[model samples]
Target: MTTSVPPADRRVPEAVHRRRWAILGVLMLSLLIVVLDNSILNVAIKTISTPAPTGLGATQSELEWAINAYTLVFAGLLFTAGLLGDRLGRKKVLLAGLAVFGIGSALAAESGSPVQLIVFRAVMGLGAAFVMPATLAVLMNVFERDEQPKAIGIWAGGVGLAIAIGPITGGILLDHFWWGSVFLINVPIVLLALVLMFWLVPDSRDPNPGRVDAVGVVLSVIGLVLLVYGIIKGGQLADFTDVKVLATIAAGLVVLAGFVVFEKRSDHPSIDVTYFKNKVFSAAIAAIALVFFALMGVTFFSVFYTQSVRGYSPLQTGLLMLPLAAAQIIFAPRARLVVDRFGNRATCTAGLLIIAAMLAAFAVLDTDTPIWLLEVIFFLMGTGMAHIMTPTSVVIMQALPREKAGSASALSNTFRQVGGALGIAVLGSVLSTAYRSGIEDKLSSVPAGLRHTAGESIEATLGVAAKLGPQGKALVGPANDAFLHAMHVTALCGAGVALVGAVVVAVFLPGRTPDAQEGKEEADLVPVAEH
Candidate 1:
């Protein structure tokens, strides 16, 4: 066996090191901006409501689609984007992605209608598909094996920070400016990222990359979009009998199965199916998906609950989320150390359980529940999320060979994106169904006119109520109460799902040596021991 130096000793050349970290900063910033935009619009929902433009009226599915469309497209195209990055250059694809994302955001800000916003959001998602995987692959290139875990930890921490702070930042902007301000905010950040990337980021591509499978891309995208659509509408449609939903879901599955067959037969595959054979990689990917599934669900519900149920203003709702951001920031560095010491299995399970418990606790909350209680749950969720999120990427990438790092990272991210998409689709559907049913029941005794309005979405209810002044406000109290109850039910469902995820981790996570890539290096240093 050949002797291998430690990653520190095999450091990147000094000239490259300086330039590399600078590029890393730019890349991370761009990624942070992408993540931050995901939930920043949540708090702005109420702010966007005007007498005319209004909130999503009788369009709960449309609103959920608006929120999830970006993630859906992102998840659908991630593998394709990564392969493209390998075929072309990472920097080239990344810059192109930023430009597309910036243009999409500008269009979203200028959107005159809900359909316009949703379409632009999908455009943004398509751009993010390119940006996210390229960022991860580029980071893998920049950092050596021993350095990778730390670097990944930092990157994950940045993502958590972005998620935590996004709503609050959006709220602040919404309070000071128009609701469109949230979308407009992306322009400056993306511009800066584009400029810095051009100046500092180096370009690299695989010398002999495999062919791009256009058929696979088409199949995967169609399957994912249909799957997401089915899930988003599942609650409204009869779970068993809705032909549209059932057909769409069935079509998605068939397409996905076909896509798998195509990949197995293709001379050049988008994802190396062999990666799933590794126990560490598989477990890590599963954990990553579960964690994100819970994370997205909670974040989505929290903003709606805080602003809609608690009578908090958009800015107030954002301010309420401060503790979550604070906890993540404070515990980020320590979370990595804990993961390293305890190993991934224990730390990851603990984190998921904590999140599940927090979600369960939120379920029991009423509109009268104190802010202190909310803060406590938010803190636990944030800390737990920080712990859970940091190590999965490290473990997954470390489990793979160096040559496969780019593909592996892209696949892991695909799982994460899938989790987020499912969370929004599933949980949003549940919430919408419950909220609508509750409104119908609550408004049953009201005047026929108001009852018809109650049959509409909460957005329309709020809009009509707003025009009625104090009497209108009083009239809508029961509807608001019902909505809060529905939110509580949504929280319970999320908690149960998270608990299932916790069980998944405990049962499936392999108790293997940590940081296998580093372990491989260590093995190269010593002679083989006698059996």
Candidate 2:
């Protein structure tokens, strides 16, 4: 009540500040678990769906639900979670997230039915919503302005590492244990992260937090869920013109538009409507979205190409895919240097161009393509992605006010998740359509029943081929050729998308002219309050 402390004296101790790096480790570990969870389940899906002592006899739709449930819930709740973190406390929300995730993992491993597993996965996604945004928000709060790009580089690299390791890890676990072991692995990692985070991470919250935007939350959740549901359904049915699909998408878009208008008019908006006016911020978001779109599309085909076409075991396929992740790990940390020397606009454009070229290269792949050549393509693709992801993320975060870090992080990640989902839906539909047409044409001489069964998927085609004895041998050549044709078409489409993103990055992303950018940074680097 008596004395006023100096501003410098009010800042947290240097020792406490120095612990930020350690805190980042915990944050990365949390991020790794979530990222790994997304892909690890892919390897375990067949095992979980089979009928046996170790399996649940899940229907095809139920298996799809197991994956979609997690994605839908995660995407739906990200903004709300971010808002809660900023208003309550990031560390508090993060701890709660970790607890939920660990518990969900434990329960999921013990689940006896597909429905139970899907429900638990949704719970895990809710935890992920809290954890993902908090990680980035905390990183921005703790790191100095100059150091942020490097920190983000590491964080992005960790995601790349998770992508590479998840399938391999899942395959190993499934080989030696029950399919549930893949889910169980998350528990120990979550426990370790919880202990480290509690000890090292500092708590931070908005000093003048506003009231929760309940209406905005409801609108966002409903709109996103409906939109994703439509997309997933369209992909599954390969029918965008279906009445249900069209109606749901239309309704979701209308609701989302209403949400934007409401936010702009609200006094205590969940997200600052004006932030989108920053060209760099908007462009960075677009860049990240498109990068993921192209990456996911290619990845969907690559997995099929390796396992279904090349006849690699799950472990071998995972090992073969390592070049992509290894390149990102090696190059991502150095991306900041490139951005510093060049600029975000230039670096991102270059990266996108590289990605476009690689995707185009992938279009020409056939059954006869050399494994080494595929490895090189994957490596270059990862290198391009590393260049794009880290710099764009840094640019997006830097453009926002420090107090809005959580919301900004959530916005960034939400766009990424949406883009990935759309990629899989749209490109997957393209692949499926082309495969169906080509296989149907090629199987003109095949029995109608066998042809219909084989037309469903490459896996089913091979399975049917095996069952027909010597006559099944005739199906192999046509099926392989048809699948490769579909892959080529999908890759070309992805390349076109990447090229468009490159043009957008080049034209819209602000350049880092030294005087203007440095001045802006200096003006914006006001010290935020520390807990």
Per-model TM values vs. the true structure: 0.87, 0.84
Each prediction's whole-model lDDT (CA): 0.73, 0.76
lDDT of 2 by residue, 1-531 (tens): 000112232454576678978987888899999999877776566566555565675533455556657766777677677768878898999999989999999999989998998899889988988887777767766776556656766775678778889889987887788888999999999999999999998887766555777787788767876776676566445567999989988988999899899999998775666899998788888888887787666766677788678877666666777888788878877886898779889999999999999989977788878899999998998899889887876677578765555456667677777677667666766776677777877666567876765675565576667777898888898888888988888788888999999998999887775967755774554322100
Off by more than 4 A, model 1: 1-16, 48-58, 140-155, 237-240, 277-280, 339-342, 398-402, 444-453, 467-471, 512-531
Q: What lDDT is reached at residue 77 by model 1? A: 82
Q: Write the per-residue lDDT of candidate 1 for residues 1-531, one digit (tens) a residue.
A: 011112355556566566766767887898888888886976876555443443334256666677778887887787778778878898999999999999999999888777888999999998888888777767666666566655665665667678678887997887777777899999999999999988877776766656777787788888888888887767654153588888888988898888888888887776666677777677778777877787777777676667766778787887788777777677755765886567677888888889889888877777788889999998888888777765665566457664454566567677888887788778777777777777775554456776555544566566666666775676477666766776778878888887787777777664545477546743432111000
Model 1 has an lDDT value of 0.73
Segments of candidate 2 deviating more than 4 angstroms: 1-10, 13-24, 42-68, 110-118, 136-157, 196-207, 397-406, 441-454, 463-474, 515-531
The lDDT leader among the candidates is 2
Q: How far is candidate 2 from the true structure (C-alpha RMSD, Å)?
A: 4.9
Give candidates' CA RMSD values in order.
5.2, 4.9
